[model samples]
Target: MMKVKEFMITDVVTVTKETSIKRLLEILVTNKIGGVPVVDAENKLQGMITDGDVIRYLQPKGRTVYDMFTLILVSEKEDLQHKLEYAIDHHVDKIMRKKEIFTVNPNDDLEAATSIFSKYRFKKIPVVDDSNKVSGVISRGDVIRYISTKLISDK
Candidate 1:
């Protein structure tokens, strides 16, 4: 069976909670990557940051045009738009999602990889070593490409 490490990208670009949005955006645009693992100075996985995070930081707060869907507007002392704008000029810790981040070991099978991808619906999965340091990343696109080229295409 194919292993996660087999198709995982070894050279991963990572950022820290302290990484600014400008820098993060530069990385995403320059590398054309959807997401990057958020790590500490020691390279330990802190969280995951993505283009979604960036967009989350850009969303405006107000009533929107919902053709058929319901729009719930809650009264707030501070709105999301204000926070996002403040975050835009501030740090990543403010906007980056720090929830239950899923990780995979490099030696795990592709089945495990697929399961994680399916369950979490994440574009990229961080590959960690024995030390829990991000060794690489395995993206859904990579897995699909791998399966198509090596599994489906092979007799």
Candidate 2:
């Protein structure tokens, strides 16, 4: 009956809602992490932001013009630089997943994390305390590592 706190990463990287998209990108690259939890000044959970969200937000829209004769006229694709110039200044809250963030408590069983990961395919889940303060983070890799080192080896 292992607990999430046993395998979760206590040294979690986090960001504030007002953090700029540029800074977020830097954090991701520097940390080599796919996602992070968004927290308030008190370290309370706010939302989650991931590399996928940033990519989707920064992707440039493409435009196509068609003539009445069903012929494609001008097809213009917005350049990456064009979109990044404007998006870099935006805050993470604009693109962060703010709704229905699934979380697990530090005292919860490891099975809780497995359930969420299997059901939602989440890369990470924030581990919170009784007051909703972020305590740690559990990733799919963390679960697998724990199983390899602890569970399977014991069997």
Candidate 3:
């Protein structure tokens, strides 16, 4: 019965709500991670942001085609660029997922964390303290590695 603290990554990368989308993207790319937890100045968990969220936000809205016989298809390429620029300049809070965030406590059983990940299909889950402060993060990769080395080893 391992605890989350035994396997969670203590050197966690985090971001604030005021972080710009451009910076967020840079962080994600630089860290080679899919998502990060958003914390406040006091280090309290505020929300979560992921590459998927950014992609969803940047996806173009549905266009309506009134006529089927239109010969000249005018595409607003500049409009799309402008929209992306605007979105990137905006803060992360604008697009971060805030509600129904799944988290685990450092003292919780590892099985509990595994259940959450399996049920929600989450790539990572933040480990918080009793005061709701992020102490670490645990990813699916971490769990898999632990299982491979500890449970299924041919000793």
Candidate 4:
């Protein structure tokens, strides 16, 4: 069976919990990646952050209205740009998904990664060592490319 290490991306672009939203956006755009694993200085996996998360976090809260018999209250909708201006300095921890993070080890079968992708529809999964230190990352694109180049071609 092929191992995750055979196709995982070793040159992962990771961010710390303290990384700003602005910095995360820059990294995602520059790397042309959909997401990244959040790691610490020691390279231990902490969480995962994605462009979708950023968009959800940055989305302006919808206007709300409340009525209490005689009193009525309404909140105006916030502009996206206005919200972004304030959110740019916020740290990633506030929005990064820190719970139920599914990971795979380098020695695991390639099926391990595919299983998670198929079940959760996650764009990527972090590959960690026994010590829980991030060693690499595997994306759906990576798996597809590996299948096309190695599996199908071998047939």
Candidate 5:
């Protein structure tokens, strides 16, 4: 049976809890990635952060002003804006997903990994070893490609 390691991306990009949100955004955009595993100095998976987190963190506080004359969404300053920006600049601890990080064992079957991704619709899953150290990242795109090439093509 093929395992996750057979199809996982070994060159995984990771971030630390102290990584600034601004710099995190740059890394995501530059790498064209949706999410990254959060790791400590010891390379242990601390948590995970996604683009959704970034968007949620960046959403303007309070309601938007609908201008009747110009018909536009007017921007207004709120107390949370500064706080969000500040949180992003200092570290990832403030915005990382501490509760719902989904990880898979390196020896796990690909089908099981696929099931997890399908159930959650997750963009990425951290592949970890027995010691809980991240060995690679398995993304939705990788799964799709693998299915198309290895399964569909065999049809």
Candidate 6:
């Protein structure tokens, strides 16, 4: 049985919680990756951040409206420039998904990783050691490539 260690990408791109959101966005675009694992100084996995998260953060939220028989309340339109400036200056820890992170171990079976991805719809899973330190990362693309090249061959 193939193990996660055999297929995971060891050169994982990571970021610290203090990393600026602007820098994170640059990393994602330059690497062409959907997300990156958030780590600490010692490389311990702390959380995860994705391009989707950034997009959602930047998206202008609609103002709330409250109305009653004779009373109506509405919020004014938010300033887009202000919101963008705030988001870009904030740290990843402020917006990163810290709770309920889904991770796999390097020694775990490939099937385990695939199952997690399938069940949670995660594009990538961080491969950690027993100490919860990130050792590598495995993505859906990695699995597909492995299967295509190793499992199915022109014969």
Q: Which stretches of candidate 5 lie over 4 Å from their true place?
A: 64-88
Which residue runs of candidate 6 sit more than 4 Å off their true CA positions?
Answer: 64-81, 151-155
Model 2: which ten-residue window has the lowest total lDDT? 71-80
* Candidate number achieving the greatest lDDT relative to the actual structure: 2
Candidate 6 or 4, higher TM-score = 4
Candidate 6 local lDDT, 62-145, one digit each (tens): 555456654443322354455778789799998899987999998999999999989999999999999999999999999999
lDDT order, best first, reads 2, 4, 3, 6, 5, 1
Candidate 5 whole-model C-alpha lDDT, 0 to 1: 0.84
Model 4 stretches with alpha carbons more than 4 Å out: 64-78, 151-155
Stretches of model 3 off by over 4 angstroms after superposition: 62-80
- Provide the overall lDDT of each model, using Cα atoms, as 2-decimal numbers: 0.83, 0.92, 0.91, 0.91, 0.84, 0.89
* lDDT computed for candidate 1: 0.83
Report the candidate with higher TM-score, 2 versus 5. 2
Ten-residue stretch with the least lDDT total in model 6: 70-79
lDDT of 1 by residue, 40-117 (tens): 988989888899978866765554445567765643434664655566556677677678788889899988889988
Q: What is the lDDT of residue 58 in candidate 6?
A: 73
- Give TM-scores for every candidate, taking all chains together and pairing residue i with residue i: 0.81, 0.88, 0.87, 0.87, 0.83, 0.86
Candidate 2 TM-score versus the reference: 0.88
Residue pairs with backbone atoms closer than 3 Å in model 6 (clashes)? none
CA shift at 140, candidate 5, in angstroms?
Answer: 1.1
Give the per-residue lDDT of model 2 (tens digit) for 31-122: 99999999999999999999999989877666455688786633224456767888899999999999979999989999999999999999
Name the lDDT value of residue 27 in candidate 4.
97
Better of 3 and 6 by TM-score: 3
- Per-structure clash totals for the candidates: 0, 0, 0, 0, 2, 0
By TM-score, is 1 or 5 better? 5
